[model samples]
Target: MVGLTLLALFIRLNAQDGILLYPDSYQFLLVIRGLAESIPLDAAMGAGGDAWSAPFYRLGYPILAFPLHLVIADPETAAKALSLAAGTAAVPVVYVLARLALRSRVAAIGAGLVTALSFSLANWSNFVMPEATAVFLLTLSMLLAYLTGRAGRAVAVAAALTTALLVFVRFEMLLVVPSLVAFIALGAGQERSKVLPAVRLYLTSLAGLIAAFALALWWAFGGVMSGLSVDPTSLFQAHVIESTTAAHQGAPALSGLRDFLDREPLLILAGGMGLALALRRRPDQRWALWLQMLPLLLLYGLRNDMRYFALLVPALAYASGLALDEGWAALRRLATSQRAAPALAVSATASLVVLTIVFWQTDLTN
Candidate 1:
């Protein structure tokens, strides 16, 4: 875990120097600077002028990066550092998530390695945007939510808090709430006697925390939604309906998903197989995991931005790990049963060659 995290950090650090800064990156930098300099939220929101709405509404990333900004004295560098740190931290979190979901150390380590080396995720981590931070928090929230069944009430509360923080980082992540509820409820159902109590406690705590957080945001910023956009219909139209319409006109609805798959074809293919296997082998967790991934999948199906798919990396890494483990086991069995050592060696070499070509053809940073 430590080695994988360091590898991820090193890669991100190297990737940071040459990365292009987008409009959103500057918005995040403005938010970080505002927070570090003790500027009021409203003033900070207006700091970017009328061109870009202040990203101050997504307070979680700025709050985390502000201290680093004060110390580093460079908002962009500080934001990048925070992103790199969160991305690196997610490697081990991915490992733990994979372990919990797959029950195999080999699979967990594979997941960790995949996360450490994931090109799309690494690219996002080098930016001054909130994607990396959101991904980290989302993965952590998933882990905590998954543990609620075995770890009990405190973990459930922690999951809710983490989810609240996640929403603060990326309002789109609010979609995760229903998925989390499904995860907790399905997990609790395993404890037949305690199912209702567990579900009630988890749901009640999540609601209370969300309500308190929303009120606090409203009190502090005069609004709970992102920026000055308080109208739910406007927010929905801007983020969802407009994107969907544009996606349909510009390209296929699944273009974003297709582009994501193009970048990591091997992992996606393996992960799909692994998920199918898991559905059969881990009946208890199948729906929970499916629900966790469904919302994002549906959203991306209607959008053409591949960057948003970074949120799915942790889950895909875990499934890829499972597939890799199963493949290795099958190979060993084949080699042993058929006494085809030479054939097995050639096949392994050919497989590696194909993977090398695929990776070599794909860009690790965009």
Candidate 2:
């Protein structure tokens, strides 16, 4: 099943870069190209010619893609390779998350299926963006938090460090770190019945966060070889704030959200339905749901367009799965007394409507 998901993931891979949607991807490619061409990592390349040669592109993607310099001839080919690898790595992480959350093979399989078949993953799996890598790390990071009880502090620390790397992969992920920390702290407190152990564990995990920041600095500032700001909040504010603030950005946050609400009302209904399910069982799971929900959820009412609200896809899809699973369970019980078909029909119709609109919009964009 998981293998099939990877196959599904691989088939959607594409090497194209379109700056109109988001220009930073090309800049990243340029950075990798510079390293491939043996350009001095320190020298700042002008934004017009090769914006990527600057220090900000120095993150882990270059390190991971370095081997491509020796092999792939085409620049796009090389970039695609790394992106594919990252997207591929995310598959098992989703599987692991499913196993941890549901603890049932069928449910885990279902969860993994929902994650892998995500149209967003399919569309951008091979696109020259760090989204796949960042998402992979995000899933891993969440998995680590979910597994905090079973794993030792050292393991949790390592997972936190990986998530720290994700912060560089995509700045929006940083928003979830607090919820994630809360998730970890709450779990630790419950297990040991002491807050100090959880505190120690949480602090130890900060090492990974520090390491991630150091790597990001090196990537952005040329790893001690160039001059660039190392401040953490720089990218976060710029990408999420300024880009969205652009007068007519492709994915304007609020307007897009309004369009979604006005057009595809079902997705919102589905999300609400899913939230209700998560709320019902394992009240403790509420925080995990919230941790997974926050970063992308806040953009809901603000989405000016579909693409602008894209960050919500994975999180929402997970919610959809939760809703689907929970809804089905309730329907099963409802079947004994009343009509389960109506509930099933409603979820299916809502999901189908949402998917259809999104797919149509995607084709129109193409």
The most accurate candidate by TM-score is 1
TM for candidate 1 is 0.84
The count of residue-pair clashes in candidate 2 stands at 14
Residue 97 displacement in candidate 2 (angstroms): 1.0
lDDT of 2 by residue, 108-225 (tens): 5545654555545545556666666666677777677656644546456766777667665555566776666655654554565443454367556666576757766466436433
- For model 1 the local lDDT of residue 326 reads 74
The positional error of residue 214 in candidate 1, measured at the CA in angstroms, is 2.5
- What is the lDDT for 124 in model 2? 58
Candidate 1: tens digits of C-alpha lDDT, residues 193-237: 555555567678777886787677557545322235455455445
What lDDT does the true structure give each of the candidates?
Answer: 0.71, 0.57
**Per-candidate TM vs. native?**
0.84, 0.74
Candidate 1 CA-lDDT value? 0.71
